[model samples]
Target: MLAKFLPGARGAVLPLAILLLVVIMVVPIPAALLDIFFVTNIAISLAVLMVALNARKPLDFSAFPTVLLFTTLFRLGLNVASTRIVLVHGHEGEAAAGHVIEAFGNFLIGGDYVVGIFVFAILMIINLIVVTKGAGRVSEVSARFTLDALPGKQMAIDADLNAGLLTPDEAKARRVEVTTEADFYGSMDGSSKFVKGDAVAAMLILAANVIGGLILGPVSHGLTIAEAARAYILLAIGDALVAQLPALMLSIAAAAIVTRVSSDKDLAGQIGSQFGSPRTWTPVAGILTLLGVMPGMPHLLLLSGAAVAGFAAWKLHQIERRPPPPAPVAAVEPADQSRIGYEDVSDGMLVRLDIGYGLVPLVDERKGAPLMGRITGVRRQLSKELGFVVPQVRVVDDINLAPYTYRLVVGGVVVGEDQVSPDEMLALDTGQAVGSLRGKTAKDPTFGLDATWIAPGDADAATGAGFLVVDPGTVVATHLNHALGQNAADLLGPDEVQALLDGLKERNPQVVASLTPQPLALTTLTQILRGLLAEGISLREFRRIASAISIAAQKSPHAEDIVELIRPDLGSLIVQKLCGVREPLRVMTLEGQLEGLLGQAARADTSGRHVIEPDLGRRIVDAITRAAQPLIAEAKPFALVVQPAIRIAIRKLVKTCLPDTPVLSFFEVPEDKAVEVVAVIGASQPAQAGHFQPQALPA
Candidate 1:
């Protein structure tokens, strides 16, 4: 029934209420009406106080400033209405205005006008001097700081959005919230002035009523001086008290709101949780107990207070000491009686590490687990190199695996698994060990090298024997790092591509904006970037990539064509990272006979996946691996500089057998950098390319 009337009633209520307040100021009201309005004023003040106290933050009560303005207008209207009633009826008696006013005057102050005046003055002073002034100052400071921090907050939201941490809708919502917070604080700063002004208005209204009533009573109503003073003074004091009471409550509410920090809990909850610590309450109780035993102290009251505090502290301490409850085991419902739901099915982690129960200590921090920290370091390093944040490796216990085994999973597929004793160290034979130790034989998970799981004390002996020794934690971390790096292309999806564009837009916005989704779709960009990553190229030179791809994309939408076109421009970065700043680039070039054969085959094989015959492919891969052996052994970077036509084909073949070898073209060698041909793969060099002799290997 109320809902039926609410639709029509809502539109008229606010306007009519304002109109009534205006009428109260212009016209006189009866004693009964004054009593209703005064009680309403008190009720509204209490309601506002409760709401303010319950608010978790200033934004939670965003409409408070407007409400404050209306309440102040209402109070001033009441003040005007009450003053008129008191002056007009002063000669009648103290009860002439209303029972509420007469009760406040006679009952509250024992029928003494001077006492009532003094009491009203003290209340006004508390409101004006303390609460109102302090609240205004806080509001001002909060507003200024909020505005000052707006730009930084906006930038942080943009950064999160660009990093794919926040969706577009979430970013928009956060921006709106930031803007609203600044506006709310600014409004509060101005609204506090209304409260201060109201306090002043209340005091002025009281003085005017008292002096005017005293003069009007004797001159207009024919009352004696003592009688007029007594009647008018008591009425003035009562009116002042009624107005000042609500004003004081509002001042307190304003102070509470401006001082409140953002929190999930209300005032009472915050106080209870923050102050519940046994460590805090125990010292407080000790201080109170010591103070209670002083000679001049009131023994009974002080001792009783101390006893209550001590009991509370003890109870809190007991609660803190209680052991946490065990986690409840999930009871599986009978399959024959239960129905399957969407909740029963779930997606798996993007990257996960599952270890057996015995190896759990490798991930537990208290047990000195280093695998978790190492995985985090791997993620940080890969994020910088791969141009996207690698998702965290979710670690869990898997009862199905062997006690010393763990599996690495990517996108719910098991890519790698290994077994290692956590309490033992792996000593790897780098082909230069001078001695040997007896332990369980195994291959290194990262590089597939011969290794032995030896005792921890055997690490010194192994290292002295020229073997590289590593802990089980490093073994797992190295495997995870290599696995991620090898499959980094698979991780560069449309979301990662968009993140790259968003980051580039910050520096070169127009270039990125014009390139993405305008001429080229996000999928096309992803494919182009993934192709580059597949060849072990870093996407860190985002500006150069964006500029080159924008121009290259317009000519051909094919990812291969774009990568081929952009590679020459990014040649210096690739070469410098491999050869360093000052050293000559030591690159191995294909023999002419092999180069001619690969080029002819590449031209015939337009698809770029297949170029040489299977037999020839293996022969070429073997020859390149043989040539790169010296470079690999010396721990130096090696690249095969071939014809541009066959470079793509060679890279595809080399990536499978020799994933670390870089395949570059003559065009990709920067003109300013000097190059030295270290070895020829299939035929001897003409001796003009470099002094290093080449061994002729048939391909």
Candidate 2:
């Protein structure tokens, strides 16, 4: 059982050491071991200071706060142990406590206990008032500022992730680093109090040793006043000095860590790189030289300093004046400026978005490239709805475009062009806005609705007024999405059709094997799929489509005939897209006489297409368009149910005006679904407006 936990056993050392320190407070220790403990405390303090100085940033030494606590606790414990030894055995000699304390007492203080006392007082003031106090304040302010900046930094990370400049893992790592920095500063703020408290404890420990040792030396051990002063008082100051020096070092280390600015280089390197300029050193050399020549100054030392400063200034100046190294040249000759490669002339991207210079910030990586992320989302959504991987939209800056304008191109043709201010939002009045607003009046780029370009700050007010507000990136993205929908048929080709078949073959091999590269060629299949997409049908269910095409191909040899034969198989899919299974299908129809006239012409011609007189054709188109307007106003999906022979002719006739409205044959709708006739074309009756009128017909 222990073997499972052994890997993490290394973390137990710190707790064991802390427990030992706690024991030392109550237990008495001999002089020999006490010397080792005192030395180890000083060494730990020095090592911590060195590590603090070498850290490139505060977070680089994230463990310093915990280390500060441990070192402070251990130093206090040493003071406790050494104080016991000093009072109990001071009558013997200065070395009674330990050699480490004796050297500080006798050799450093030179038997003058008063001088040692003054030195310890100075160290205490510097640690408590100067270093520890300053570090605490810096940590407090740094923590506050770091937390305050958190929201903006997090948004920047998200923007970069969406813009494709950073991968998800890299963004996650940066977020962790930001959070750790905030935590480190907060810990440092708390840890600085440990240093302050340690300084206070040192003063108390000194007093305890001196007062306790004095009363005990003469009364308990029968020593004279002179001998007692020589032994106990000096030893007290010495022991306090041993602990006080390490405390001062820790205070300095805490200050250094909290004050440090994050950088790629260490403290010494940052200082040298920033301060080595001749601009700073030249003034230093000149000022020092003038001071050296002053009558009251120490001429020799000041002149020597001036000379060294002058030499450093000259070296810095020479380095600054040196030119950078020349870039390496390729061995091959350079191409002529006028010459161009195929990459310059050919564009591999099927979809491209070009923005003007004024709109560059929307796609600028430093600005988080908000448009790039939005474009990526548009491509992802279109790819999902179209059942094929949409080509990447290449965003480029074009100088030829006017300011704030962007153009979307599909297959080298400009499908859409519009303008949107990068720093403004569009507040669209979607038939619900009640109040008037003051701003630049414009039409919604995606749909021509009344819109105003308003500042982002006004978004709440606009929403309160029932306006739908969206950002500039959203406006551009939605425009691009709309354009892609209209041109979806152009997005598919032979390669895409083949990929579809191959994917279907993986799961439904028989269906694919019977359909493709057999009765129908790849080009014919591609054209058929394009026709379906042109009429607002998605190929998401590729297996079903492949099976339908396989069955339809058996009765029909031509691609158009196959499409007609396959309509019954795909009826459910088409109806489901237009409305839910439970919702009745809303429809418009040609009057009996009008349908027969077109049907007769369709049957008379060998070709599927039927020609009608231009005036009559115009009247028939106007009647259907007028009838469909009410359905459009209500936002209901409806189709024109017609004779199969004339459905193709009717479809081509109305396609230019009502591209999204479906033209279905009599047998296309599922038998289980209910149908509500919204209008009957060419019928002499009262016109019904904005409501469904139910009617019964022969089966």
Candidate 3:
């Protein structure tokens, strides 16, 4: 009843009990109460030991570290309480402190204080030197190893998640478990010190009790030196023994917890299953029988051991040979029925990779499934950069595809389709290859570079000719990566958004709560995030995005308005993808008159949107494309800098013509960045000019 607080059932009771521990040190208590508290301490320690023994793994008893500290505190408090009682009332009789301590001193130790002291010393040695020391070292090493393995385990979960072997929920749960395991070991590393200190404290308190009692018994209680020795020494050893026993149990329990390996069964079950094998006990039976026949040995004892070992081996052998219980047979179907299932009506897989018969060998596991391995790598890298887990890619062999073709479908639409010869290698010439190979040439499926489908035997020769050689599997993976990156927005939905919100809630619940179920609901947030993704924004910094939205929602109820308000906060994320921090942002600007014309048209419009006339829109698109050639020739990263109000309008116009260029509003470029105006479209240069000089930004 006193220990109900320790198990964490009634949280309010724990503080009161911890206060009581402090009270026990300073306040006096009756012998009867002391005995009851002593019994409770022993009971709690025994319970902890049994729990540790029954646990299949260390994490099963995750609270062991806290429990260890409380148990140690309780033991120390009792030591103080018992020491005071013995010093004050020792000369009274053998029962001065309590029946518990008195029983330990007189009956258990046979009324010999010297013998009791030796026994207490031995128990302390076992607890401190053997058990406590060993468990502490084990905990230190376990914590270090667990921390070191964290990164590799995290990567494996990411790989499994992206490769479609695990769902998003399972991946999240696994990540939490890995982090918890690391924390548990780290805590245990420190908790082991408590047991060691308790063992040492028990020894010091025993010495203090005996010495103090010796001084008081003779001077104040009118007892002789011999009488004082008999009373004080025995009482001190009794109090020490009572406390030392429980401390030993706790040490053993701590050792058991740290040393336990993960298994499906308890310690006893593990030991029994492993040791009861016929092969193990058969050797024991043979050794015992051989010893039983020796002349100098105890024949009767060895022969009895041989009989038990032989019987155990026989029983284990019979059990091993015993057939497993018969399983119930399933019933046959009553009739053949045609029915519609959910799977037939709806397709759950968001991305599907269709391959022709010639690509079958590349996906077959018996032949090493090289394509499957590369695809998993691509999924891992793509998921990391995109900031959300992409849905599974269902790779199916399609008969409709040509013998050498592969198709990538996102959301039931074929976004990318290409061909690769399964038995050949692709050697891409990056405008640096000196020699040519006699092979059928084609454009690279991903980069549009001139490539040749050369035989596998010619891969080395192609590399020797400065050609970048890749297998059919790498070619397919590269194309799929490109297609997925372009269509990433299609992969996100309410489920993924809710997943992001739920994950964010773990770290920043206030942001999620403020943003959702308020000015912005789930569907609204989903659409807003999808819009950003479509505009080539990554959600890797999800917390920043959510915070920006929460702040922006106060200004507008519309999703578009909220998104526009949040774009400045998302500016850094956007600029990073185009160029590094130290590099200047190369951008093309609209001519002053042309931009002024668009802004005036936007304000004069009735619907709050402006559309350029057909001839004018065509002229603008042509001019932007022509101006972009300078940066393209320099092979540098660039975007079109425009007014914020007309940014989206211009993005739609230039996207198809120059899909690689990102259109950024002026405010979206972080202020710290230096700007270089690569060109001015709609200037004096003709719309169809082959090239134009770029302008530099004014100071």
lDDT of each: 0.86, 0.84, 0.88
Residue lDDT tens for model 3, 547-627: 999998899888887778898889888888888888888888888888898888777777855566667788888777776
Model 2, position 123: C-alpha lDDT score: 80
Clashing pairs counted in every model: 0, 0, 0
lDDT (0-100) at residue 602 of candidate 1? 78
Instruction: Give the number of the best model, judged by TM-score.
Output: 1
Ranked by TM-score from best down, the candidates are 1, 3, 2
Evaluation by lDDT, superior candidate among 2 and 3: 3
Candidate 2 lDDT by residue in tens digits, 1-699: 233568676677666787899888888988999888888888989999999999998888999999998888898888888888888898898778889999998788787998988888888888888888888899889888988998899889866644445644577689899888888888888888898888888888888888887789789998888888878989999998899889889888888888888899999999999999888878888898999999999999888998998899999999989998899886998779898988898678888999999999998899899988888888777877888766678988999999899999999999999999888989999988998887899999887899999988899999999999999999999999999998999998887787677657757888877887897889888888887888777888878877888788778777777778878788888888777778888888887887888787788888545677677777777888877777787778888888888887888888867878898888788999898878877776555676544222211
How well is each residue in 1-699 modelled by candidate 1, as lDDT tens digits? 233678878767788889999999998889899999999999999999999999998889899999899999999999999899998887788888888889888888888999998898888889998999999999999999999999999999976654445665577789999999999999999999999899889888988998998799788988888888899989889888888888899899999999998899998888899989877767777877888889998878877877878888899989989999999999987686476675467444578888999899999989867888898788878877776767667898999999999998887777789999999999999889986788999999988889999999989999999999999999999999898888788777786677677667767889888798878889888889888888888887888878889998888888888999989988997898788778889988888887898788878875657556888888877887887888888888877899998887888888877888889999999999988888887875445543777856763
Q: Which pairs, if any, clash in model 3? A: none
- TM-score of structure candidate 2: 0.56
Candidate 3: C-alpha lDDT: 0.88
C-alpha RMSD (angstroms) for model 2: 14.2
Q: What is the TM-score of each candidate against the true structure?
A: 0.79, 0.56, 0.69
